[model samples]
Target chain A: MESERSVVIAPEALDDLIGALRRRGFRVLGPTVRDGAIVYDELDSASELPIGVTDRQEPGSYRLEERDDEARFGYAVGPHSWKRFLFPPRITLWRAKAENGGRKIEEEPPNETQLAFIGVRSCELSAIAIQDRVFIGGKFVDRDYAARRDGAFLLAVNCGEPGANCFCASMDAGPRVRDPYDLALTEMLDGEHRFLVEVGSERGADVLAELPSVPASQSDVASALAVTNDAAARMTKAMPQVDLHALLAGSLEHPRWDDVASRCLSCTNCTLVCPTCFCSSVEDTSDLAGVETARERVWDSCFSLDYSYIHGGSIRASSRSRYRQWLTHKLGTWVDQFGTAGCVGCGRCITWCPVGIDITEEVAALSKQEEKSHAATA
Target chain B: MATATPSELHPVGAFVPLPFRVAERRQDTGDTWTLTLEPEESGFAVEPGQFAMVHVFGVGEVPISVSGPPERPGDPIVLTVRAVGAVSGAICASELGALLGLRGPCGNSWPIAEATAGDVVVVAGGIGLAPLRPVVLHTLAQRDSYGAVSVLYGARTPADLLYTDQLEEWRSTIAVDVTVDAAEPPWKGKVGVVPKLVATAEFRPEAVTAFVCGPEVMMHFTVQALRERGVPDERIMLSLERDMRCGIGLCGHCQLGPTLVCRDGPVYSQADVGALLGVREL
Candidate 1:
């Protein structure tokens, strides 16, 4: 086991870390400015990061703004998550071709590359852990996901500023780095513009031994803790927790569902942006020659009416039922199925929703309705 | 972490469909056909009430119940498909010697051990009878273990009724009563809904275990009538139908509230899923 070690690295030495990972043959991915928002993509040097930039995010709104100081990691989650790279939106499971009056089936060739993710927030790390439960920890392990996960490396960042929609503190998933990462870094720009690096795993210590860094002083560690605690105190949003599982489960018939459904467009933006949503659909298509076929699995959202379609008609014909299913399944029944809440409180669902349907607000409204019903019953 | 169980019985991922040679295909009604498929490899057996995701070559795939017995492990897997949709229609049009893709023997099975000690009543409606045909066959094969077995079925018309020959052959050992919603001039038989036949059947409510399958509306009424007869909720089982794409729990298409019908059940006791059945658009 590798003992915990902390060090102080100047802002300029960040390039050495990127170079070290590249030397290790890892395709390093980090946040960069693209399409007027920060998106994760290939980063060859630390200069590619969104330097001196912060993002303003609200329900159904996101915009990049220039910060007074150079904060390399100041944004919350973007529209895309790490799920796109891990459990890709589309993957071919197998292929088949016509043979002598029969068919010959072949397993899909395994495809995975060595990956190292940089600028990963604590909430996103929790989201990754949630997906780990679904794809790898379930009764039947997803072979494709297991292969990619085995060859991946993670470098997590502590959140020094929480977004307006973020509630990771309430979910107990963020504002502080708790889970194991290859390397953890906390940016301290208040007095000295330097990063406090904490080595977590053996791989993290190996990389730290290569970089030139001095031992972190007591003040550096204390300042890093202050940064995370300040972010936790700054968050304005929170999830209501008055028997939330039972509240959502029993409130299936609550009239507030109709109100939310009326505002919802059912465009499937939430599920697409959600980090922990794991529902998918399979499609089998053949070539124009009519001899070859390929079965592919793609990400699917419960908001679609066709998601529940059978021989007769759609099971959830109304948008009200669909929205209710999405909410209760995420916050309530997910605990029953996976032994954890489906949400990691990254706030991507709220920030990317088209009609500004905030989950925190909706859960609070439902909790209030349950309280009123309880009072009346009493 | 440890890898999953051995690969022979359980594959790493449960999505791949293997090829099964269609040894024989017989049309029972105008739109319904039964295909007995011999797998290229042996050791794949299917129990009653389980289903298979049958791929129709270039078209697509649909879930059809295995309406065959599991008495022998190497016996051909049998499926009865009704050509109501595009994929099933393509399946019904396939040749006898052609090869189709098959995935499972997936989902839960009927509780034969419990039903054997009590009186069994099998109720079905229209094409919904396809999944229950195996239950009827299993009960008769083990007739000595059960008491006063009965089968009550209903169809839209005489032309829509499936497995008439087998239904007639089973009459010597068990009480088989069938009805139709409408009939032609020369037809002389019972003409009403399926639940009405349940009222006229001879079985002790306290000692009976009923299995019902059919269209959603028909199943709703059949469960209501069975409850009125004083059959306890747990004693009545129903095989449900949904848009099961993956035929596994991974796909969220078949979820009904907390239950994934593909995994938790296509066969659920009325007591387990009764409250959810009548909930509108749930």
Candidate 2:
């Protein structure tokens, strides 16, 4: 492991580096500026990248801004995530062609995957962790996710420019990549935009050997640290730290909920943007001739009314209850079961919330008011 | 929908539609239909409150609780189904002894061993009683294991009451309290809902653990009443009813937030449902 070290890639020859990756049978995917926002998509060359692009994000709002510097690792999360590439929203679980009255079952052929994700933030890695628990951790693993996860590799980029909506620093997920990556890149794009690449696994080191990268000097390491430390300290968005699980579980009857519920659109944008939210609906498709039938699982949300339907009625029939369920489970009770906070505190819920309902703010308010009431009683 | 070729049994998570013949159909009320299925293979083993995916090959599959007993685990698994959607409607419309597909006796059931006969309260509202029927049967069979048994049931109206025959038998043999939302002209039973009756009914709170299954509104009210009566959230248990399409905990249709209703529960206490209780649409 000590022999596995960092390599410094020159900024001028970034395209040559991308070519090296392509030659090694890696379909390099990364953040590219598209439709006024930085989107994660397939990048064939360095020219397709978000070279001089940045982004602006707030609670329920997002905007893109171009940077004067020709740096690539200058943004946080955008509309596109690695989930689309790995766990697609819709994939053929199985397909059948109906023949005669009885439907014949056939094997669904598996597809090959050779993706190499670039610039995955730490929080996104954590998100991948959550997804792994769902798809791979269970007894019946999703074979498709398994093949994709195993075949594809990662190129985790350290966050040099944090978006306004970014809360990876607060969530303890990033500003850097820590786990589940092949190569973790510290984009020391300050003064001179060069990459400090750390090979996490054997595959990463093998990829590094192909690129024209130099052994990093002490100053290069220090320069990379300085860039990362600055961004970690400069994270703009935060939710206050309260015992999230306890606070949420205790405040079942808290009246502040009504105030928040009034503004929540129940549009499910928070969940859609959320990398950890994995709820899906099952659909059975029959052929036009009405012989063969196929069943599929598609992404579903708690916000939908039909999700809770039983005999004649739906259990959770109101928006308020749905919001309460999503937030409480994400922050509170999830700890008791999954042994971790369901939320990585990405601030996507805060920013993508059409109502600007910040979870951290709510927990803080609850704590403050409870303290006040207790003092009054005392 | 990319569907697999319909195989006899699927791979570990493969969707296998187990075609069974509905040998018997019993209508306890105008709304609820109970079917006894005879699958080609035996060993349709399940516990009380666990559910099975009843499929109409052309229509779709819906999750209905296994209200049958463990005594006859291999014979035929009984499903007390209520008409709701296209698939359920198809099953209801189909003749007795009609061919149907079954997938599972999925999810955990009520831990009957946890409840002693000291004093057990079985509360059901409308068709919610169907899921609890197996527990009732199991408890009745093992009469000496329990102390005193009482079943409290509430329905929309006299005409809406389900399992009328079974309720009559339980009334004669066990301590039973049946109520309706509104009493009819000839109705001599309790007029109020189940919660109002349960709050006043005396039972041993120390030794008693309640099994309450009902509409979401009724269960909430019933649970609140139980908690107010000094029963711990853990003691006062309720089975949730959700839109279960796969019934195998895969489809998010049965999820109440992160808790898979088909897996973690259809049975939850106030402690479990509290997070989910706030979200009405969940």
Candidate 3:
């Protein structure tokens, strides 16, 4: 069924697609080479993409190297996810001023940027969907996130290069593009540099109608499927097949938490790089005369000492407790809160952790301990 | 690229606070003050155990429980705040006629409606009495609707006790037993933890609905006392406190296990949060 809607476009026509989006008033953002990493940034043309670049990622490591062939979207995800754009780092919530011996409050205007994201990975799409539930699916919605997300265009790219740390297959989140995208592209690098683009929405069909392209051949569709299949086959890491929520719930008192705490740093690197972490804190700032004031929301992490602060002191003060909170919340209680796991298995948390603490490794240890306890009880 | 109409945007007034003028202010203690605020435009209706996000313009916002009876349109909203942090301190120092921002009546309310036929036991410690004040007032207004009603209250010292005059007034209608952790030589009353007083209170333990609120440690001990006295866990209601920023549950600061305390509860039965309370630093 997908083969009928799929079309083929040459490598040069990628620039035309960007032009069409920009002409339609979208601020196109895509992957680009910056500061020795492939980070998402504003792109005026396809020339700005990380051409001939591939990234090698492992726990506590990321390195960009040249690929043997020119595959534009060859690399797995980098440090930046689309979260920083949809849910910005800092935003003014409202402003207040002293007016005529009384206080007058003013709300910040709704965001109006129509974003067009390029090179979005499948795991990232799941992350976006998870955040959508967090922000908009609840009883109270975040109007700002809704504004940016509703008007944005998502261009998904099927994965052909799974990072060493990526375990999206185990989480059932990626390696193959899914719904909630405008257009899904599978970059084919065999013999000819072309793309098999499948239209996921009407807007995608409209854009494809404008671009110079041909209906995808059977061979082209097969090549695209083979690309994702090979990528999935190449994945080396996977989350152990167990009920993660029950595992963490039963293993809360396991001694592995203390062992992991000895090596875990509460540096908040994993949360910042994660695509679905949405915790935040707000700040109220005032002018010198104390007449004008504004409140701004900023990203916050559970690993921070002040994140769980009450009147007397921090709740999760110990490194063991903080790490336990992050892991348990992401893997265990998040399912209970949002009806899905908070983690996408994108491996950003693993690749960016300075201490090289791996989530899958920790879970495996906890699972082993749980089995031992059950064995003794039996 | 198309512009979204206003209708397409979800009405998100959750973060915006409504203006309320401080109509009356009374210092309950040296550190605690109760402010009765009249809404400038619309009314702020709240249930018994619900709370409000009170804002002092330039300082910050903090969640304070409504301490007065349920109000109608144009009625005043009441909040009792203690100067424990910078935001509460600013709210405590606000003068009369000062305009403050309020964003609540957020979170689930106590199951007062479900306790009609059952005896009600209200246990409060220190400033925790503020949130439970409405429950007492509501039960007293319809005095004949239930069996024996009791109020067990405790504070750090006599000087830290809130609503002293009302406590004396309520004694004539219901069993009001007050205790302090410590007192001077002149003070003659029960001088022990509030949980100890819970055992001596007169009520049918099997048929009583217990509402307990205080510091976490105090509430834990009170729950133990109630359980020991044969009160069921589901009937033991508790109001919990956590660091809250956005009272609407978006900020993710008030999570206790799977529940966002700001959204799912400021109030929960002992059966709901018992395991959560047992876990240290959860």
Best of the two (1, 3) by lDDT: 3
Off by over 4 Å in 1: A1-4, B1-12, B69-73
> If the candidates were sorted by their lDDT against the true structure, best first, what order would they fall in?
3, 1, 2
lDDT tens digits by residue: candidate 2, A15-122? 776676788777888888878877788788888888887777777788877788877777778876687766777765554444442334444544454678877888
Q: What does candidate 2 score on TM? A: 0.85
* Model 1: per-residue Cα lDDT at residue A308: 90
* Candidates 1 and 3, the one with greater TM-score: 3
* lDDT accuracy of residue A331 in candidate 2: 79
lDDT of 3 by residue, B81-197 (tens): 999999999999999999899987899998999999889999999999999999999889989998899999999999999999999999999999999999998889989999999
Clashes of each: 0, 21, 0
Number of the top DockQ candidate: 3
Kindly list the per-residue Cα lDDT of model 3 for residues A176-263, writing each as its tens digit: 9785899999999886899999998888888878899999999999999999999999999999989999998887778999999999
Cα lDDT tens digits for candidate 1, B13-92:
56677777788999989999988888776536777888888987667888888888445656788788898899999888
Worst 10 residues of 3 chain B by lDDT: B1-10
DockQ of each: 0.48, 0.29, 0.63
Which docking class does model 2 fall in?
acceptable
